[model samples]
Target: MPVFGLHIRILGVALAAFVVVAEVAYADPTPDFFVLLERAKAAPRISAGEAEVAAAEARALQAEVGPNPSLSLEVENFGGKGLYQGTDASETTLSIGQLLELGGKREARIAAASLEAQAVRAQQTRNTSDFAAELAVAYARAEASAELAKLTAEAVGLAEGDAKTTRALVDSGREAELRFVQASAELARVRAELVQARAAEASAFARLTAFAGSKTPFDSIAVSLLSREPRATAVAGGTAPAVAVAQAESRAASAKVTIEERRWIPDITITGGVRSFASTDETAVVAGLSIPLPLFDQNRGGSAAARSEALAASLRLERAQSEADADRRAALAGLAAASQFLSAQLEVERASAEAYRLAQVGYEAGRVPLLELASVRRSLIETRRQTINIRLARVAAEAEAARVTGRLPFGE
Candidate 1:
């Protein structure tokens, strides 16, 4: 065969070997991130938050309804010695009283309740974002752990191969027994590491499954890096759930102040009835109105308390906005740092992998020492581990950014 053909065949064989190794390492397919997040929404915490929002909406709708008219029946001047002693001499009155709200009190109450409902909805949004963030982090952790385990498994394979070669050389008197012992020790160490890596992977998967509210065991997680925009542009300026909730609370508080002030308007109760006089067999229509006078307390304490609450709500809104801005900045910074580090780690991984390959080839030809080959293999493993960790961190930071900016990741 020509040299070029030999090189092509060798490359094809290497590629085929890599595919087989990868397939053997991970026989199970990984689940998508969005699917995991959707499952996470079924978690009990998130469901409880949804229920709270629904209850708040119901209350808000109830606030829009007016008070029901009250019906009363009375027998006036009854049981008196002369005119009301018996049923024949008694006057009976049956009436319905409708309380009419003044000073926009009904509107104010509805407005306050509506704002409160909005705040609850915002709280639900925040809860959803929090759940997404939790799932993202857990998914990343599971993915990283699995990848690390795979790398460790590969390392163990290399160490086993090295040990076999060392044993053969020792048996043939080409190498010392000490070298064989060292190679065997390397294999044992790598096997132990592989076991630990697998345990960590299992623990991470357990956490992901628990967070996702899944009963089935997940074999692996498939993670893809999100295409991020510029930091300043990507950090959305829209109202985050926390900030929206705070703002809605402030508006609701202001509405409550109006409601308290309107409390002094004194609702008028219009009573209309039919009066029956039993003795004369006469019936007459009667109408009356009642209003409470604001003599001692015209809702002065209520109004003052509402005003103070409104001020507190306003301050809380300001704080929420400030914290959201700070969170955005911090998440963006973490993403930038992790991305940069991941870029460097990629270069290191490529270089270390090639160098380890060359060292392995040299060791097979007796040109490189076994110790040198083992060191190169360890370096390659570390590089791969670091790369996985950095990728995990970058993904986590992106998820946090989406959460803080009220941008649901994966269009969720």
Candidate 2:
């Protein structure tokens, strides 16, 4: 397939799972995390990376092509002494010469260029995976921020009601003025927190939008902040992009080494044409061959550099594989930890909500002080915020794990 066709196919597959933001048709009116990833793939950074891959492919195609033949015209002996002074005394020749590559140089050139293109493609794939992971994390943070803002609004409302009740009780001489002052202060503090929470939500949304390079406003996300645990069978197999890119570079370097070594075999140029002797009115066929001597400058330096580069590439490949393995193990452990932490936060939030509800009832019945009720309410809000944060953390960990293992949230 053509290079442009390959680029189009790659972009299509990357963006296929999600609809464009302007064209969203979901019944629930919520966008998935994959949708954010789709947008991210269209971001400037990703497009530029893919463009580099296409350029590399184009260069490889150029490398596969042979050199063009040269056409030559010669008027030998025309400017020489007595006998060659006139045009009739000169012999004119017209010929075409083609350079023939020896020692498999053409094949080596093609192989080197092709392998370099492959390496570029591998790096592009790795970049996409990393960008996708970043998008997922940003989306999670935005959604969690929204949730926290909502919870904060709820706390503000509850604090306002408590302040009003405390004020009424103080006016009726049923509660101390100091208690009412404390309640007013708590209400003011909660109101200020609500403002901060909203600002945080806006900041998160801005980050998500910028990262995805979308002009459309992201009001809400539909993806679950607490994703299900990844199964062992879902881990991606074969070499990941990091390892594959290194291996390709090694192979490409090896091909370059071969190309440099082939420099020892000089290129041959074969020429054929017709020569005309004007004075005798005679025309004859002429054929010639030319080859350079490799006595000096036989590309020894280039060969040594290529060989060293190949060795370095081989070592990098090994290191990349080792790092990928270590990253995979670490990501899996983090995912498990985040999952357990989210579950614990959920339980704590549920218990806090119940306690706050009971505290409100007891306060209304005069069995609980206004201070205690206010304390429970703050605890509940804090727990709710923590729960949202933990859920976001779990989703981020899941994304990172998938990225490290070369797995997609949706099957690749």
Stretch of 10 with least lDDT, candidate 2: 21-30
lDDT of 1 by residue, 166-235 (tens): 8988898888999997887777677666766776776677667677877666767554533333243566
Best by lDDT: 1
TM-score against native, each model:
0.86, 0.88
- lDDT by candidate, in order shown: 0.80, 0.78
Pairs in steric clash, model 1: none
lDDT of 2 by residue, 204-268 (tens): 77677778887665656676544445443445465666887788888888888998888788899
lDDT of 1 at 361: 85
Give the Cα-based TM-score of candidate 1 against the true structure.
Answer: 0.86
